[model samples]
Target: MAMTMRKMAVVAVMLVLAMAAQEASAAGGCNAGQLSVCAVAITSGSPPSAECCSNLRAQQGCLCQYAKDPNYGRYISSPYARQTVASCGIPVPKC
Candidate 1:
């Protein structure tokens, strides 16, 4: 019983580590929450500010991932969002 418990603990630790690694690798290491700086620009069709552009560029690779999310997809996939990305000099992702 003790041996089984030890093995279970090890397995749990391994699973946690794997999840952490996956989360870190997702969205090209970007956390979409960081893109809040661009919210106004994306929603209002205004030119993005320097800080918004910086954050947008930083998360360039995550655009597709954000576009695939139900909660965020609409915003990321909107025409305004595309314009905002282009205004920032980043290519809008096809996704």
Candidate 2:
């Protein structure tokens, strides 16, 4: 039973990693984790860091999908997020 559970856990982790890879790639070169850099600014009205801005610009192609996410959509579409993106000199794509 212990061995079976361990195998199941491994499989589950693999599945999750696979799904995450697919989701990130689906954005056409966007890595979702890069956007996490802006999470603090997005949620707390803080200034976006240089890194955050860089990620925002890099992840521009993923903006539309981010906007539509049920959990994270609000943060991505919030005024703060827009400001953060613009502060980085990145235009918020109209999607």
Candidate 3:
């Protein structure tokens, strides 16, 4: 039973790693974690900083994807988030 449990754990870890790899590939070079710098601006209606703008611009292609994500959609679609993007000279994605 202990060996069976160990095998199951290994399988579970492998499955998780595989899923993570699939997600990374499907992300099309976009990593939402990079946008963490803009969290404060998005939630507080504060002006985005230079780093935030840079990351936003870099991840422009991924904005729609981010908006569609349940984890990030709320913030990505928020009025404050739009304002923050505009303040940084980035356009809010239609998606």
Top TM-score prediction, candidate number: 3
How many pairs collide in each candidate, listed in order?
Answer: 0, 0, 0
Listed in order, each prediction's TM-score against the native is: 0.69, 0.67, 0.71
C-alpha displacement of 1 in model 2, angstroms? 46
lDDT of 2 at 53: 84
Candidate 2 lDDT over 1-95, as tens digits, reads 97686556435434433454467776567565667666667655679998888878877888887678664566678888788888888888798
Worst 10 residues of 2 by lDDT: 9-18
Please provide, for model 3 over 1-95, each residue's C-alpha lDDT reduced to its tens digit, 9 standing for 90 to 100.
Answer: 97686556435434433443367576568776667677667666778899989988998998887678665566678788799889988877776
Instruction: Please give, for residues 3-60, the per-residue lDDT of candidate 1 as tens digits.
Output: 6865564354344334433554763585666666666666567788999898788878
Q: For each candidate in the order shown, give its overall lDDT on alpha carbons.
A: 0.69, 0.69, 0.71
Identify the runs in model 3 with alpha carbons over 4 angstroms from their true place: 1-28
Q: Poorest 10 consecutive residues of model 1 by lDDT?
A: 12-21
Q: Give the TM-score of candidate 3.
A: 0.71
